[model samples]
Target: MDVIERFCNIYIDICQISPDDLESIYAKDVVFVDPITTHRGIDAVKHYFSNLLTQAESCKFDIADVFHCDGNNTARTQVTHIVNWTMHLTLKGNNKHITLDGTTQLNVVDDRVAYHKDYYDLGEMVYEHVPILGFVIKKIKGKLAS
Candidate 1:
């Protein structure tokens, strides 16, 4: 399959919640970097998603745009994530609901993903969710604003 087609297949498989399909898209030694942690190898990558799926609900991804260059074997996807619609995030021991929007850059080789980097605001994901934490962070921001 072509690079673009390969990417689409991988995306569809993921949307189907088949983490094992990563084997077709990720190289034997892949590096995945995100706001949470850095993972190496396909198994580690699968584990990361496994954990996230367990904690988050809905977990739908809306692809806003995809910018790809077949020559460079690289692509960038702007996406919006809606998580936990009916459920709430447990923050420091409290339940909170949140949504996130972010971009992901993928480096591909041999039509398989090699290095993946995810960009997003941690505050919008974590601090903004918890009531007490969000309030404290907001108050702290006031002092740093000047």
Candidate 2:
């Protein structure tokens, strides 16, 4: 399979992220960004994933869709891939599951991801999981929406 397919297939296994695993999927100077963190380089990416793996009992991603440019379908191309996903995680030392729905934009270079950005609501992913902050944030949102 091509790098893009392999990337989509394996990148979701957050529990087993390693440099070796990402070697083919991410460039050496890859840039990864999400709502909470911005990091550069593959090691930084690995560190970020390690932190994520440690926080949750188990984490998994369910991809809803992936859209990429149509071309020669080389290992990497001037393409923007949009992936919709739902991540399931066990947080706070509890067995409860917190699922976050998110979308990621991936830019590939030379068969590896050079730039990756994820879009999701901080409230849905984190703030709502906190106690007092959740309540306050929800109240503020309700007031603003109404």
Candidate 3:
């Protein structure tokens, strides 16, 4: 399958992705950064994904749009792809459905991702999903928006 297809599937069920698949999809020194954590190297990236999977009962991505830009086709150089997506996850324990709006920027080198970063609201994705915290967060947001 193509890179975009692979990318979509990978996030849908990160727990199912094998180490070999991780190796194939990311550069050895790939770096990943998101709201909660930053990790470097494919090994670290795999670990982060595994942990994220463990926190959620289910994870899925709704890809809104994908844009690809090819750069100089040379070793060590990368092409860029930006993905605008929504993440739907069932939070552990509470089983609350959390839908977070997000986007990802990927730098691809030799068909493998060399760099990745995700943008999303930590409050919407996690804090606001907590039982007690959810109420407080909603109230705070209401006060601020007024």
- lDDT per residue for candidate 2 within 41-70, as digits (tens), equals 999987877777677677778888999856
Give the total clashing residue pairs for model 3. 0
Q: Write the per-residue lDDT of candidate 1 for residues 1-146, one digit (tens) a residue.
A: 86545555445324347677667777778888889889999999988877765665444444556675345322332212211111123322334446567777777666667777778878878776577998888888888996
Q: Against the true structure, what is every candidate's RMSD?
A: 6.4, 3.4, 2.8
Return the candidate ranking by TM-score, descending.
Answer: 3, 2, 1
Clashes by residue pair, model 2? none
Estimate the TM-score for candidate 3.
0.83
Error in Å for residue 35 of model 2: 1.4
Model 2 has an lDDT value of 0.78
Error of 1 at 53 (Å): 1.7
> Can you tell me which runs of candidate 2 are displaced by over 4 Å?
16-19, 70-79
Instruction: List candidate 1 stretches off by more than 4 Å.
Output: 1-15, 69-96, 139-146
Which residue pairs in candidate 1 have backbone atoms (N, alpha carbon, C) closer than 3 angstroms, thus clashing? 89-96
Worst 10 residues of 2 by lDDT: 70-79
Model 3 ranges off by over 4 Å = 70-79
